[model samples]
Target: MWYFLMSDAFTFGAFLISYGTIRFSVNHWADPNQVFNAFPFAGHANLPLAFVSLMTFILIFSSVTMVLAVHEGHKMNRKGVEKYMILTIIGGLAFLGCQAWEWTHMITGDHTVLVDGVLQTMGTTVTNNPWGVAADPGAITAALQKTPDANLAAIVHSLGHGGTADAHATLGRDQMISTIQAANLHVTTPGPIAFGGYFFGITGFHGFHVFSGVVINVIMYLKTKFGHFDQRGHYEMIEKAGLYWHFVDLVWVFVFLCFYLV
Candidate 1:
């Protein structure tokens, strides 16, 4: 297992290093703060890094619980092992739920804006997001110029200060959609498509590890409940599962830093 983890480490490290190289080489990379600002039930309030911080804490705390479970297993305490393992499973599930919501938001995007008292709809293609380099007026204006018409120009005029002028502007998702549409343009993905490809691939791989750890924990919890460990006169299965769980948690710390915080 250790050897497997070492190999996995190299795989993820290669992806992250590639992401870093591409990010610095590009004219624009999406700001992590702007991209991950949304929070549940916050009504679109900008709460950058808060939710991911919570996710990180949950995973780390579950690692703590996993340690406790292992310690209890050393004492052959079935109840303690079951309890901590269950907590660890809950933590894993919560993290998965958070990831699901995040992916949904990212893919669907913020694509509706009220324009002149009318709500408008826009969508994200593989090539667009306000968080990208599209916040440059010159780029959007130049793009619009290629398809010049009175209507597109009017859209550009409305998007004037809101679209590209304020690079760090926290416009509503809907308003951003409107601006992108009016500009008749698509912003490049943060840095290059490779950045996103690595970001999603590495994170998704970690998430899968978390999910598998949860399943292993659940089975161990059930075994404890059914007296399987008691018959064997040992709870070492819990300890083994705990090692994997801790590994998942440790990997997440690196992931959060590379993909979210940094």
Candidate 2:
């Protein structure tokens, strides 16, 4: 397990290094603060890195529980092992749930952008970036003139001016356009395509490791519950699993630093 983990660390290190290289080479990379400034159930409130911080806390806490489980295993305390393992599994699942919501939010989010003197809505994806540099005032004004009534209304609603979607949809086009022009609204011109690529790739890889760790913890929990480790006169299996779980947690710290913090 140690050898495997060391090799895995090398792989992750290479990915992060490459990501940094490309990020620095780019003239304009998306701002992490703006990109991650979102919280679940908080409409339009800018909370930078808040959700990811919660995920980091949960993973670190799970690592602590894993350590406790390992210590319990040393004393042949089956009940303690079961309890900590369950906690670890729950933490892993919670992290996965948070990640799922973040992914959905990013992919399905509606971002207004100026393209060819026309305003269009798009979301972040491997080939598209909606978090680019701010569009020029001239370009924005031109696009607004060419924007459809419904699109204009959507933009007004996104800025928190037109009420609920249902109510916002009933608003007149002239009123929607007037609301948008009165507000300090800014649209983007599309950022580097590699931004979304690396984001999904590296984060997805880390999430996979987290999911695998959760599965291993579940198996370990079952083994403890069934007396498998106790019958063997030792719980070395739990210790090995602990090594992997800890490694996963450590990798996340770097992942969070690379993708979210730095």
Top model number, lDDT:
2
Q: Which segments of candidate 2 are over 4 A away from where they belong?
A: 161-170
User: lDDT of each structure?
Assistant: 0.70, 0.89
TM-score for each of the candidates: 0.74, 0.93
Backbone clash pairs for candidate 1 read 112-174
Candidate 1 lDDT tens digits, 1-262: 6777788778778877877887788777767886788798776578999989999999998899889988888898888888888888889999999988887777666432222223322323344333544335454434433432333433343443444423423454445445656555433323345555666677888988888998999999999999999999988788788878888888898889987897
**Model 2 lDDT per residue over 1-262, tens place:** 9999999999999999999999999889988898888899898899999999999999999999999999999999999999999999999999999999999989877788887787777778888888888999988987888898777767766776537655775777677777888876778898889999999999999999999999999999999999998889999999999999999999999999998898
Candidate 2: worst-modelled 10 consecutive residues by lDDT: 160-169
lDDT for position 128 in model 1: 36
Model 2 quality (TM-score): 0.93
Clashes of each: 1, 0
Reference-based TM-score, model 1: 0.74
For model 1, give the 10-residue run with minimal summed lDDT. Answer: 114-123
